[model samples]
Target: MTAPTTMPKFSKENSERRRIAKQARRLSLRVLIVCGAAETEKQYLEGVKGLYRNPAVAVKIKTRDKSPLEVVRYAAAFSKSDKDDFDEVWAVFDVDEFDIAEAVREAAKSNVNVAVSNPCFEFWLLLHFVNRRGHLNSYKQANALLCKHLRDYDKAQLDFANFQDKIDIACARAKDIDETREKPYANPSSGMWRVIGQISPGSHA
Candidate 1:
């Protein structure tokens, strides 16, 4: 008769730790962005998501016609509503006519992030072509500049092929401006890159 087989030592704690790490590697990032359903914002974000084609990242865009504070509240509420809700929720809006301070404060309480563009989001798009240094008085002025570079520019069309190659440059320019400015959300400023950075390759978030 063969001698009784000896059992190998196995650490339950080590097994559990390995399981958690494996799950983390498989877990995908889901982001919900509430941006008043603006076509321009939706198209641009979708373009970025499409370009990456990463199976580990998912991006959903939601639109609301409410005030900035309301948008922030909605995003926060949605994020807390379910166990399978988005991993990150963002409120994207322009600081044109609304007092965004209250929204920013509320977002902090609700654990929601904000990606605000001063003047408008067009400035962020314009950065793809040129590194602008001054304030764009209005969205119109920003759009005009973008048109000069992007022929037949229209928000309805999600064609960002022209800007895709230069996205890295745009991100760098935006970061430079953000660092030099006191109020990062002021005119000629945009925090969109923060959201974009999360979905970029090699991002653990």
Candidate 2:
């Protein structure tokens, strides 16, 4: 007589995990972020994505060392070309010396979102530690203020862990400053919270 074969037992935990992951993928929101700076903005965004680890949100970052207006235009073009790939497209840039009024208008017309940090993106990083309302004269000023909070702050290399736990506080501060602003590109303001909210809704809430 042939020996009876034993069937392997299936684990419920593994099956449940697979089901949840599949559901998350089905409900995922694909987002594309176009950055003006080549490093800082990209690195910060990547950090935000990593911190959230939200399977329901997919983020893609593209770096371009260009003016605010040019960045917006490029984002608009990409959004149009890859309409099916990205559910949302955002242009991240600094309100440096660029004429941002036209870029903002263009973004609106092209259905592209904008995250403009006045002086520089470092202003956004600074908000994670304190609510600074003073006007920043330039990127260097913002960078210096951020360094006060993060003693070893570096533009080329960012440490997201430093700001991870303070994300909610940063969003609140940024929102407060934005609400009081008469212009979207007002100094010492950061629109970054808008996009961050979408990536991790719980953080902004």
| Total residue pair clashes for candidate 2 | 0
Q: Tens-digit lDDT track for model 2 on 94-164?
A: 98888799989999998899999998899899998888999889988888888888999888888888988
Off by over 4 Å in 2: 1-26, 201-205
- Inter-residue clash pairs, candidate 2: none
What does candidate 1's lDDT look like per residue over 84-163, in tens digits?
46888999888776788999999899889999887888888998889997977888898899999987888777577877
Cα-based lDDT for every prediction? 0.83, 0.87
| Decoy 2 TM-score against native | 0.83
TM-score of 1: 0.82
Steric collisions counted per model: 1, 0
